[model samples]
Target: MENQVAAASGKLGVLVPGMGAVATTFIAGVEATKKGLAKPIGALTQMSNIRLGKRTENRYPKIKDFVPLASLEQIVFGGWDVYNENVYQAATNAKVLQQTQLDAIKAELEAITPMPAVFDREYVKNLDGQHIKAKDTKWNWALALMEDIKNFKEKNNCERLVMVWCASTEKYIETTDIHETIEAFEAAMQADDDRIAPSMIYAYAAIKMGVPFANGAPNLSCDIPALVDLAKELGVAIAGKDFKTGQTLMKTIVAPGLAARALGVNGWFSSNILGNRDGLVLDDPDNFKTKEVSKLSVLEEIFQPEDNPDLYGELYHKVRINYYPPHGDNKESWDNIDIFGWMGYPMQIKINFLCRDSILAAPIVLDLALFMDLAQRANMSGIQEWLSFYFKSPQTAEGLKPEHDIFKQLIKLQNTLRHMMGEDLITHLGLDYYQDLVESL
Candidate 1:
């Protein structure tokens, strides 16, 4: 099993669908890191270390060293955006990073321009741009996107390609009969069905081209049975529904602790204000519903209210996202958590998280891309539940619950890597040492 994965040999093309704040920040950050101007912080593949054996063996190594992951030097970035701005211009417009950092990698960022994108105004009502693909049926649009993928890979001399959807959330939609099978999906595309979103078309194109796809937004992009089955049939790796950043990231961390300590959560009121293109898209009630569902699912799964009814049965969870232009890419979130402990006495936990949206998401994009590629090389396909560590709504198979606890997610992720490398999976059950001590005594 250790020798099963192919080598990460040549240039890997990272094709993004929406080249806005999150996309631009990711590309620029990678460029800056490659130029030695910055480090790949918050990226587990680049920064975090994995423990291979027991606590005493001291076989700890960076995940990058432990796995055959593509390096920053091997990455070539390109993507499609509704906006025509190059990454440099987009990064400047984003206001996420300092202008000085953008200036440091100006030429590299400017050299990469967005290809025309597949856009549907009906899906994302709050945004419109002129750089959209020519008017065509959804099937034709997917064909055009496949052409884009081919041209990008050939032109960039990429040995492998992976698409990370860094796009805005579309209006809420559910899986209909058309989304039941690839044949139905293709027919719906030919018929130009309104239910087929731009992200789904992009996902179809990428997976059809044998490219691994990762969804970074809370859209039903590759989560439906159609794309999920297609990926497995084609032997391509796919994951996600939304990146677990900022507020949700904190919830996964804190909520797990509360559950572990058996503290009762009565209410959790969450609010956020952001002003990026994402915020703009999410301002629409229809589009916001998609995000709201993604954000709201975190607690129920983590808390398991039905299992512990007395602790969480009466829990109230509310989520709100306000688009404030002055905030730019800075997202400020507040969470008021009401809990109770001994004697059922109530207490409160107020959390205010002022975080850079793209800054947090950029690293997630990198990690997913690298991990998706790694999963491909390792011959893994379909929804990568292990990569759920990076997502808010982890796309699992139907009838399965997603793990929202960040700590458990990390352990699952690390253990997956260990399993990949033929190393012993660390269960953290130290009873073996105690057993040995008792035998010695």
Candidate 2:
């Protein structure tokens, strides 16, 4: 494919739709990273290495060094929130970062006050805030979001901008007739159709404005056919459904490892406790369903029971999330995995991971924002399936099954970057190198 967008230079504005815990942690983390206070640890684009040749060649380079990603210093952060607090206050409320960390970047964090949110109580029933847009119709709300994007770009002198949803997951909305086509969606927006959720409006505004949109929450967002068509029409790259973090992250990592070994999993039970706005919002059954779908699909796709019936046909996977106030953004997950191996002997693996939800999510937000911006600059548009490593239920081009294996997803992601820069892909066929070694031996 011929490249269309220009190379990434100058400032890149990352406009988030929600300035809650995940969003604030992202902003703070970026600021800290720029100041050398913290490394972009979890961000694969920033911190990981890629092998560019056969294993024996030893030609591994940092992925960022290989690809032309936006530098941490050149990223500008802005967003909207249902609460009026700035990044500093939001981070404080999130309690994900320490007072010392917030104090260190106080000036930068406090300056990033959220623009009023385009919120709907109907979509997210658990959240209530006075800082939401008063305009009732979804169309007006969408227009306001577009204006916010334009103003943020102009104000920050950004050469490019991308919007990522870091907000609470809305109630589940299946693909209805209204979401079937861009025409019907736009008409629904005009008629103030009740079926159109708040996230879809933000997505429409982003795609209409030629900004790459990524959905971090599992709400319908840009996944529907209508938005997908609009994104392609506008020639913008879009990705997501949910950020793959915490327990789901573990499940994806472990499930594949087990499946690779041809182990039979009889049952897998996952339960988590978290105390954040996301947690509270997910306390509602409707919102949890949105999250549940995103979380549950990983095992099914990874195991591929149809292909490996003996190993995975009887797998029972259950996920539960509890709102425990004491945890407060610190999500703790316990997984009980029952497996049999080597003559059908049953074994169990119990993993208890105490993780910070927003902290885990924050770097993913950074990586997605920066990479999506890079994809735009590299002229790659429409459904960034290569970014599936960072998401739970990754959005893909129509008729394509989402790949769920973390390692394969990583290879796809890295290979896409290498391909973008005209580098050779590593296929792990190192016969020549090993052959020479054997002859010498």
Local distance difference test scores for all models: 0.95, 0.89
Candidate 1 lDDT at 254 equals: 97
Encode model 1's per-residue lDDT on 1-441: one tens digit a residue: 789999999999999999999999999899999989999899999999999888889888999999999999999999999889999999999989999999999999999999999999999889989999999999999999999999999998999999999988999999999999999999999999999999999999999999999999999999999999999999999999899999999999999999999999999999999998989999999999999999999999999999999999999999999999999999999999999999999999999999999999999999999999999999999989999999999999999999999999999999999999999999999899889999999
lDDT tens per residue, model 2, 1-441 = 325436678898898988988998889988988888988789887888988766657888988887778888888888888899999998998898999999999999999898988888888999998898987678888888888888898999999889999988999879999999998998899899989998899899999999999999998888999999888888899999799999989988998899888899989999999988988999999999999999999999999988988888999999999999888988999999999999999999999999999889988998899889988887778999999999999888888899989889988987887687767776766687778989998
**In each prediction, how many residue pairs overlap at the backbone (N, C-alpha, C within less than 3 A)?**
0, 0
Candidate 2 Cα deviation (angstroms), residue 396: 1.3
* Deviation from native of the Cα of residue 10 in model 2, angstroms: 1.7
Clashing residue pairs for model 1: none
